[model samples]
Target: MIAKFLRDPFGLEDAFPPLKKWQLWLAALELEPPIFKTDVLSTVNDMAGMSGKDKETVRIMIEDAQEYSREDSRIDLLAAAMGIPPNQMDDLWKWAAQIEPI
Candidate 1:
């Protein structure tokens, strides 16, 4: 499934493609601390630099977003908070792309 995105007929792939919200959540559970989907939000809000508004924004995104854009700065922030290296984002993207939508 991920191959379709990474290896398209068009030579160019989006440097930072948006991933489905469910895919992102699934990858989170599969990858690190292995927390429940519910905990993912709290974890991000708990990050050191997050403020009240930022926390609210994250909550809203997680609750309502259809896709999580790799281009969004918040994605990087979330990855960093989760101890994922910037260069290793592809791991998350690949893992995410494999998830079957619930």
Candidate 2:
């Protein structure tokens, strides 16, 4: 799922409309923090983009989700939410992590 999203972020929107734009951001942030941070920086440089409120809302959500958690716990939660089997989560995350930022 993370691989699919990375390959075509907006393309899969029709399949998961229930996931808000911010939720997508959270997923990217958790799955690949470095790339996600770079993407956010790019977004910031765009003339027409996320407002302060929009950025703050997603930032808060990401912070709340990660509060008092270790990396393993965070990965476990994300994997569970995506219904990925525990044994396969690491490989899946590794694959997603390798994807070049768009």
Candidate 3:
């Protein structure tokens, strides 16, 4: 069921083999406000145990989020994949707001 949802938009053929999760997440952060919040939150939650390069990647993403504005469809797709609700997405943004950009 979940797999169907994740693949519905981007397709599940592995044709693009999702760029490292962090990269994808970072891309999402650059998206429009709602999507940015949702993706960043979902990514951080899904990759909770992130380490090494992943951690560094997320830090960079946080920094990027502090200074960009665009729409990222990937984030919307990811939020759907993670089953994050719209309202909660705002909380996610608030969490992101607390992070000091590097």
Candidate 4:
């Protein structure tokens, strides 16, 4: 199931690209506490070309995660919602952490 989702995310026309848009949003959310708000707004602003619905979805996901008490639970819920495995979500989060401001 995980592999299948990784190969092709539902509603997306093609295979999940290595540089998924959600990855960028995830990265912004993971920024250091002091810079999180600025980083997220900056990142979202940089992705101004995305659809309004997509932007809303990303924002909601970030907010939901923020409400969680533990990062693991947040990641687990995110993985399930995104149809990816928890391990894959972990990898994506790590990847997000390494991303530099664009």
Which candidate gets the maximum lDDT versus the true structure? 1
Ranking by lDDT: 1, 4, 3, 2
Better by TM-score, candidate 3 or 1: 1
Cα displacement (angstroms), candidate 3, residue 78, comes to: 1.2
Candidate 3 error regions (>4 Å)? 1-70
Per-residue lDDT value at 43 in model 3: 61
List residue ranges in candidate 4 displaced over 4 A.
1-61, 64-72
Predicted candidate 2 versus true structure: per-residue lDDT over 1-102, tens digit per residue? 898789888874333122233444444556533236444434433525557775555445444543322243534544444445666554544444344435
Residue runs of model 1 more than 4 Å from their true location after superposition: 1-14
lDDT of 4 by residue, 2-101 (tens): 7868877783433223433444455545544323444454465456576777666656656554332225343454444444576665565556545554
**Cα TM-score per model:** 0.70, 0.32, 0.28, 0.35
* Candidate 3: C-alpha lDDT: 0.46
Candidate that beats the other on TM-score, 3 or 4, i.e. the better one = 4
Q: Which candidate number maximizes TM-score?
A: 1
lDDT of 1 by residue, 1-102 (tens): 667766775644435457888788777777656746566676877777778998889778877999888878877867765667877776678657767855
Candidate 2 minimal-lDDT segment of 10 residues: 12-21
* Colliding residue pairs in candidate 3: none
Please identify which of the two predictions, 2 or 4, would achieve the higher TM-score against the true structure.
4
Residue 20 deviation, candidate 2, in Å?
18
